[model samples]
Target chain A: MNPTTLKLCLMAVLSLVGIGLYGLMICRNLIKMVIVLQILVKAAALGLILAGQMSSQINLGQSLGITVIVADTIVAVVGMALAVQVQRRLGTLDVDALSSLRG
Target chain B: MLEAILFALPILTALLAGIQAIRTRSLIRSALWLAGVSASIAVLFYMLGAHQVAVIELSVGAGLVTVLFVFAIGIAGAEIQPQRPIVPKTLAWVLILVAILLLAGFALPFATTVQHSTEPETTSVFWQQRGLDVIVQVVLIFCGVLGLLGVLAEEKAPLDQPMVDEIAAERERDLRNLEYQSSQSMVSSQQGQTR
Candidate 1:
């Protein structure tokens, strides 16, 4: 990859991270939070690959990216499971309503 | 020129999809948009020469994750009544602006310094050197399955007789009190009619 391409990929990764963080800050829905988290992980995976491309260790980056994907999938699955439970028990998906877990 | 455009296409698509995923009101729609973002990212990965990771991203990120989100939406109800963001809009925008500036500052230095390597053998690196990551990922997947089972498990009624009896008694008492109150109100109304 040329430096220009590398730079563009880096910018995309940064933008994705920013968007993910902004979403995390603003979104109160538990499911939305999970979605934002997935986005953040995607950015990280892309960044890892970009780093690999930069250093010429593309295989290492790909391997790490695969690791990230597996971990991220698990996170998403567990997060959704927790969200379903929260909705069932609390009768609402709003994170604001979960302020006191006293039930 | 052709290479840059090819890279730009997927990057643009990913960014747009990501923004739409955040901006969309419906959870399902947001999930779909996320799928688009993931697909585009996979494309980007393929373009970047990470063929295996790209395939996995397409399957796991775009396919499996989106399916999970839809299933979750089906069970949990799709739309929450829209609420104002926890962060005020002005502050949120300011924060985003600051974040962008910081990211540009951090990322700009690396743009000119990237050096490309000739050998791109992903298979050996994945299988030989990164064995720990693969093992840990397997463990993580198992733990995730266990966690899902734990979270979604049906809550069994307590076997404690005393606690069960106490709860039953409390419910019965509340029912009796409600009945008594209704009866008292009826008698008062009848008495008022006689007057």
Candidate 2:
């Protein structure tokens, strides 16, 4: 595809990312919130890849995105473990249900 | 034309996936949709001459982030559906129109890049100058692994005794009071009998 078309694609993707962020913000669930945060980060990576086509100096967007993926894996595993614990103790995953130690 | 079709397909799929994800009823469904969107974006990256970036996006953004989101969903549990129509339909339409206009204004300027694709890749930043980013990513992954391990080690509650020391102290005080009271009562009874 031509550069101009690719540019448009990137712009549209960014706009979608913006909308996803809005959804994440408005959504009440904590897990949904985490996913939304991930989408936002992915949007930044998209920006990085698009920028690669423009400037000659900033090319690590791919590597950075890869690294983020690896890091995020660890985050997911830990989050899962925490979820299991929360479910065991509290019997429900509702973020609103937790009110024990409010200071 | 084939290239354009290829590029357009991925972008459309990505956009649709993202939109579907955000609009889905459940967190699990939403996460899966987001994964599809990330995969499409990765393909789009490849079309843009950023091969490594595409790989990373697929593996990390698409793969890892999706997994993390699923885990979070499990932890948080399924959320109840929120009531909609809170925002007026007119406001929603207005936002959509404004978004389209704003996007066009921002993107129209970039249309000229299509006329200039033949510029040679002059920079070796990906292979040469990007060492620091790679290193940082490696470190971040390592730390995330360690953090996960730490989270695992920390159980729902630490297995140690709960307030045992305080109980022991209270028990010792009670025993002392009992001993003193018994001794005083015994002495008073003996004195009264002697009198």
Query: Considering every candidate listed, which one attains the maximal lDDT?
Result: 1
Please write out the lDDT profile of model 2 over residues A1-103, one tens digit for every residue: 4665656666765666566546644554545555666666666666656655554322444555555555555555555555555555667544554666254
Residue B4 error, candidate 2, Å: 3.0
lDDT of 1 by residue, B72-156 (tens): 8888889867888989878987898898889779767876776755764677788788989889998999988986784566643
Q: Each prediction's Cα lDDT score?
A: 0.88, 0.64
- Error at B166, model 1, angstroms: 6.8
| Model 2: residues with Cα > 4 Å off, grouped in runs | A56-58, A67-103, B64-111, B114-128, B150-155, B159-195
Candidate 2 TM-score versus the reference: 0.67
Give the worst 10-residue stretch by lDDT in candidate 2 chain B: B114-123
**Backbone N/Cα/C clashes per model:** 0, 2
User: Which docking category, incorrect, acceptable, medium or high, applies to candidate 1?
Assistant: medium
Candidate 1 differs from the real structure by a C-alpha RMSD in angstroms, to one decimal, of 10.3
